[model samples]
Target: MATTTKDRLIEATAELFRHQGYSATGVKEIVDAARAPFGSMYHFFPGGKEELGAATIRWSGAMYGELIEIFYADTSDPVAATRQFFEAAADTVRDTDYTDACPIATVALEVASTSDPLRRATADVFESWLVQLDAHFARNGLTKTQARSLSVSLFCLLEGAFLLARATREHRHIRAAGRTAAAAVRDALEHRASTVARRR
Candidate 1:
């Protein structure tokens, strides 16, 4: 299947947004990277950069969500799976010279305060990823509330670690975050187990 100009533009923009920030990235750069004609951008995105940015965020979020699901489905322990996910993420950041962090983190922080549409789009993506993690926790025997809170904590740790790791070019922070996240998940699961035992 031939990729459309719009697809190319989104792919390129998402990559740029991950490296640079949303405000720092330009439409020309995106089209140039995509190797698409300049006018095709406006034709595909009449609303211009903002529209394209939102689409890119959503696209990146959906792709990351699928990756998360794959890890959980393939692993026997969801908590360990989550740990391995962060470990892999930290390793990628190190291997890529600290340039390969979350696709949406930099853009999300930059646009969250300025672009209402883009902010909401990023927020939705973040929430969706959390929900994906939460679903994995729930499937592993956590109650809805427990799973949701644990997921939130895990994601916050990841985001925070990404910020620290990128700035420091060190995986220690992310590795620590992974440890904390794993403990949080394990604690939640243990608490749930105890509660269930008491009920039984």
Candidate 2:
């Protein structure tokens, strides 16, 4: 299927943002990378750069969330899924020479201090990811509270690990984070099972 111009714009901007952050990525670069006309950018996004940036963040978040869903669907065990997801993430970074990680984190940190619109956009993306992870845990046999907390921890571990891995140009941090996150998920699930059994 042929991709739309707006979709291309979002993807190109996202790639630029992931590499150089919000302040560094410009409309001309995005359009050029997207192979889109300059007028199309304004036509699609009347609110201009901020609007396009926010939309791009949301688009990337949703796309990445689908990847999480794919990993979860591939295995019934959420712990295994978690491990697999992180392993793939770490491998990708190593394969890409540590240039690729989360699409939103770099821009999130950079825009958090400068643009309210962009910061909110990034926050919305993170929150959406957290919600999806929490729901996956809950469906696989975790209490709501347990799922939410564990989701937060797992995401924080991943995000923090990315920073460390990028800084060190090593996959050790992310691999360790994956192991730790999987263990935590396992422990949480076991605790929930035990509590439910005692209640029964």
Highest lDDT among the candidates is held by which one? Answer: 2
User: Model 2 — TM-score against the truth?
Assistant: 0.94
Model 2 alpha-carbon drift over 4 Å, by segment: none
Q: Count residue pairs with overlapping backbones in model 2.
A: 0
Question: Per-prediction TM-score, please?
Answer: 0.96, 0.94
lDDT (Cα, tens digit) per residue for candidate 2, span 97-175: 8878999999898889889998998999899988988888888788788999999999999999989998999998899
**RMSD to true structure for each model, in Å:** 1.2, 1.5
Candidate 2, after superposition: displacement of residue 181 in Å? 0.3
Q: Candidate 2 at residue 4, lDDT?
A: 95
Q: Could you tell me the lDDT of residue 34 within candidate 1?
A: 98
Q: State each candidate's clash count.
A: 0, 0
Give the Å shift of residue 72 in candidate 1.
Answer: 1.3
